[model samples]
Target: MMLSFFDQFMSPTLMGIPLIALAIALPWVLYPTPTTRWLNNRVLTLQSWFINRFTQQLLLPINQGGHKWATIFVSLMIFLLTINILGLLPHTFTPTTQLSLNMGLAVPLWLATVIIGMRNQPTHALGHLLPEGTPTPLIPVLIIIETISLFIRPLALGVRLTANLTAGHLLIQLIATAAFVLAPMMPTVAILTTSILFLLTLLEVAVAMIQAYVFVLLLSLYLQENV
Candidate 1:
């Protein structure tokens, strides 16, 4: 009974947005949980040869409080990625295609970098924006320009991800729509369109991972600039 309601509400793109939201929020809920599922905590041997240690640095140390912030960034990316791919399924929606959703992800990451970096050493972390070696006369001008660019990371990341996903989805939708109209007279058109759609799906998979990686990597780099 409950499952049916879940299925009903999940139709069209609107349904997928909430699911993506859930995925995005999951890390927060799971952060305090120390009791791990068997799979997360242990490794089985192929021939009863060895038991490899599982719980190491890869777990993201949400419990430590020190690394909890990194966990959140990684979790957000994973959530966006899961949602982006979900839209590819028939009858599902693409959350990342929406600018608001992508901005929601990017803005927070940008804010986190600023907050964390500044908290480390407000003045020192900020110094990273200016050139390492610069004339005193030009320093003021350079700092102002670089500060503006720093402010733009959220905008840039948001636009790039949103545009790519939105455009890709629209292209695939148009091609698939065209297939129906052209199928009777030119079946090959549908075939070719489908082929293109398949290729784009593969491209989307790469984009999903790459975009997330880029976001996380850049955030880390920003942190490294200060720490």
Candidate 2:
């Protein structure tokens, strides 16, 4: 019974091939491609506008050097955003809910930012370990703590994304199961549970979008510090 709740998170397979690859690739196919026409359909127009706005806002704080990351940032944001929202659909699997996948996305990107900092400005990057005017006694302790915190960034990014989506998915399933079990025995209670489920579904949708944005925003902040 306990495992049933988590079964949705497992990667489904057909002919011994994991379907997660298809799930990850589906978002790209869903979006319409741009054409040479001056006037695009409403879908393409909206896509362009949203991408433009997101790119501008994301790069606003970044230095010109960091601005070079604009394409990667926008693409990641769209990929995450689409997958998260699509995962909310019935019978669909969410790739971002997996810690391994989230870490796969977070670690390299986080490392890239750190690498940029170290390569471009070694002094400034290393300086983050210990602040100015530190007492002689606390210097060692502070450096160790800061270094630990620096390494934990990728872990935090992965765990944060995984935990939020997992919790929301679990809650939705629990409420749904309850609503189904109680429908005949306690119609009133089941109705209330269903209503709550509807509200929670909406909140989860918002969370999906927000988490994607937050993930990218943090990367941008990391880049800002480095660049």
Q: TM-score of the candidate numbered 1?
A: 0.69
Location of the lowest summed lDDT over 10 successive residues in candidate 2: 1-10
**Where is model 1 more than 4 Å wrong at Cα?**
1-68
TM-scores for every candidate against the unseen true structure: 0.69, 0.98
| lDDT score, candidate 2, position 150 | 95
Q: Model 1, 29-90: lDDT tens per residue?
A: 43333344554333223211211121132233323433545546555655665666666677
Clashing pairs in 1: none
Off by over 4 Å in 2: 1-3
Cα error, candidate 2, residue 28 (Å): 0.5
Across 44-116, the per-residue lDDT of candidate 2 in tens digits comes to 9999999999999999988899989999999999999999989999999999999999999999999999999
Report the C-alpha displacement of residue 53, candidate 1, in angstroms: 13
